[model samples]
Target: MKKTPSIIAAALVLGAAPAFAGSATPAAPEPVIEQAAPVPFSSPDWTGFYGGAQLGYANIDTSAGGDDDGFIGGLTAGYDFDLGQWVVGGGLDYDFADISIAGGAADLESVFRAKLRGGYKIGNGLLYATGGYALADTNTLGSDDGYFIGAGYEYLINQSFSVGGEVLYHEFDNYNSSGVDVDATTVQVRGTFRF
Candidate 1:
């Protein structure tokens, strides 16, 4: 009977000991965490090329006599150097137009021109200037030849296209067979393509 009592006590002690032992503290609530996605890598860059056409109005003011205005059209080809905020390049341009002087009565035939240019880019726009030689048909009184200097600004619409405006001054010797030196100024708006 004493043995039975001792065994029962031992059983009770073992049960109570298991109850006093702590439960596993619930594993710290699984850390409640979120993770972000990895970012993608980008490729290295290279310089590109472009080309386009231009159409604009030209106004010519002659020192000897009068003023003339007409439509001009041409093509442009250029290269961009990818020089950070600025692009440097050379280009060729030509245009043809019919002009009149003195009360729209005295007419000059087609005036043809070609020029070489260099420019720098500012944001989406470009600030530039050019100087070149020019050839033209006969004036109302006679024929002439000269050099021109001009400044302009252009706004780029995309990687391949832009439009702008310019003003140029021209000086001719022996203008119109009069042995007189003459000066002319022109203002024009133009478009261009980059290549």
Candidate 2:
């Protein structure tokens, strides 16, 4: 009878062993796996202010039978606003020249301009059209008000620098009140500093 009781006790202990094993802290939960989050997409930014210099050639034609050509150079400053694929801006420039009239009657001295430009952006390059008011000065005849229109292309070298070129046509009627109509075409290579 004692052997029977001991056997019964052993069986009960064995049965309780499985129950204790099940109740033990669950095996550490399976390692969790997570995916990395996606990155955001964006476009290039090009809104700012700028300033620069230019050097190029000027060819002049006069209604009074005189024509001439020479070198011109100047300073420029501007501001721009970026609009997705397009940009618009305003600029001002002043150029000094020493071009003489073909007939030795006078010399063209300087030019000043206030301009507006609109451009299309394509892979770091800007193709634009510009037009505005101009003032032409002469060494002898005086200075006169004029207008100019032109096209240009500028490439961004970085966040603070750019290079470009422009070709403009200008008209000064009855130049400096001397009863001479003057037409000038200027081609310039430009370098700019942006802020």
Candidate 3:
């Protein structure tokens, strides 16, 4: 009976040892995989108020009978609205220049102009048209003032920046001591920055 008990005890210990060893071994640490984060999906918005300056050339054809061309510089301010692929806006601008009629013999006059513009955005560029009024100081010849119209296109080089070119026409009725009526045309290349 003692031998039988020893055999039973030995068999029990051998069977239990394998189970205990297996439990202690720690189950191969379940595969520790990790997932990556998702990226954001959205575009930037562009609608606001902007202001800038412009420098350009102006050519005037006088109906009273003289022609003049010179450089012009000015400041501009406006508000913009972005609607899908198109953007619309209105702006006011002013420019000053020293211009003369006839020849270098004639005295220099200061010319001033104010304008309003409307534009449509096409791709990275904008197509625009503008109209306004102009005023200038004439020698004893008198002063000239009139309405003007223009059209231009601008390409956006980056956010808050653009460059453009335009052509404009102006008409002055019965201007100055010369008693001559004048019509003028101007073309200019301009650049602007937005805020």
Candidate 4:
């Protein structure tokens, strides 16, 4: 009778092994995460040094009763500082021309300018106003000091190249000691390479 009880107890423990394992709690599964994508395009940086050229027409009128128009072309260089929504710069320009006065009185030969510019930033460009001092040269009338004011717009084709246009009004009270007033209007197309 003692041997029978011992055998029965061992059989009961073996049979309960699978049930005990199943009754215990199972662990939770881990989570899966996804990441977001990045943007593709951005705005341009306008602060730099630049050199360029321009070509256009000039209409000249004089107090001596002469009026005429002809070609004007020039090279320019400048440095610009970008200030958040604004940009400012200073530059120089030298233009060559040979527009005649009506009745062959004189030929306007060339002009040199020292310029200051400031503008509002618009997309990939600037809408700006410019003014400066200028020296006007003529074949017969000699050279004279003058002032000019203008407005322009510049657009970037890329980071390194830009194109623009301007309209300026220039005035001189005396033409090289001749006591004749001169006024000029100029329109130009400009191209630039930036560094």
Candidate 5:
């Protein structure tokens, strides 16, 4: 009977030894997997007020006379509306033109214009067209009222600045007090500060 009890105790100790040993050297826990964060989508934003300077070439043709070409420099200001991939805006500009009559001492003085602009967004640049009214001064003929049409392309250099180029045509009938017609074309490079 005592031998039987000793054999049972030994069996119990042998079984319990493995269980205690297993507790001391447990299986390694499963590795914690981590998922990467999703990447953010980004695009340029173009909604604000802007002002700039323009410098370019001007060619003026008068119906009663000949053609004259000279330098044009100006300042511009506008506000833009950004609608998805399209942009709409309105602006005003004043220019100092130095064109003179082909064979006379008279010259074109300055120009003031009001325009509406529309553009399509491509990457970080905008391709646009503008049309509006223009008033021009002459050294001999006096002040003339006209209309203008233009097109341009502008690219954002950063968050606060942009650069662009434009070409515009201006037409006037019965210039000043004279019964003469006038047409002028200008090509300009522009730099702008955005807000």
Candidate 6:
């Protein structure tokens, strides 16, 4: 009886072996890979020293009701600090004017200014406002001290170059020790090189 049972178990094992032998089990699949999108670029760095030149039109008004209009040119130098989206700086500039007022009897000679500027970064450009003290010389009015306020827009051409436009108003009280007042409004275009 024991020999019969042993023979039966052996036959069952031999029969089950061939069914699993011919077919191999499949392997686990690899995980799917996904790529990420790139990020966009932001504004350029504006922390540096800069020097430039400017040319523009000047329109002068006097308390005597005279209007002086002509060309103006200048040089500028400044340092800027970029605090993320805001920029602040101070600059010194000198301008020579060819403006004639009082029917060519009085002409503007030169202007020297020290100014402070604050701006916001907008795309590839900067929009700014400036205020400063001005010292002006005239052919007949001599030299007078004054103040100026202005606004401008500047665009970066590259890492080293920029271009801009500005509008400013200047006022002098009791000019040339005379009872007369002088005011000048200017529209200018500027180019700058950064270092």
Identify the leading candidate in terms of TM-score. 6
Tell me the spans in candidate 4 whose CA falls farther than 4 Å from its real position: 1-42
Off by over 4 Å in 5: 1-41
Candidate number with the higher TM-score (5 or 6) = 6
Candidate 3 residue 131 C-alpha distance from true site, Å:
1.4
Per-residue lDDT of candidate 6, residues 1-195 (tens digit): 879988999998898887867756665789888887787778998999999999999999888777878999999889989999999999998999868865676789899999999999998899999999999998987889999999999899987999999999999988978888889898999999999
RMSD versus native structure for model 6: 6.5
| Distance from true location, Cα of 25 in model 3, Å | 23
**TM-score per candidate, chains pooled:** 0.59, 0.78, 0.64, 0.79, 0.79, 0.81
> Would you list the clashing residue pairs of candidate 5?
none
Q: How accurate locally, in lDDT, is each candidate?
A: 0.62, 0.91, 0.70, 0.91, 0.89, 0.90
- Model 5, 1-195: lDDT tens digits are 779999999999998997877776668999999999997654478899999999999988887778889999989999999998999999999999867853564688899999999999998999999999999987877788999998999999997999999999999988876777889999999999999
Residue-wise C-alpha lDDT for candidate 2, range 60-84, written one tens digit per residue: 9998887799999999999999998
Q: Given candidate 6, what's the lDDT at residue 85?
A: 97
The TM-score obtained by model 1 is 0.59
Tens-digit lDDT track of model 1 for 1-195: 779999999999998885688674654566667687887553211134545666666566554566677775555555545565554555555555666654464444544455655666666676777777765554455666777888888777765667778777777666656664555566667666654
Task: State residue 171's C-alpha deviation in candidate 5, in Å.
Answer: 0.4
The deviation in Å at residue 185 for candidate 3 is 1.6
Deviation (Å) of 166 in candidate 5: 0.4
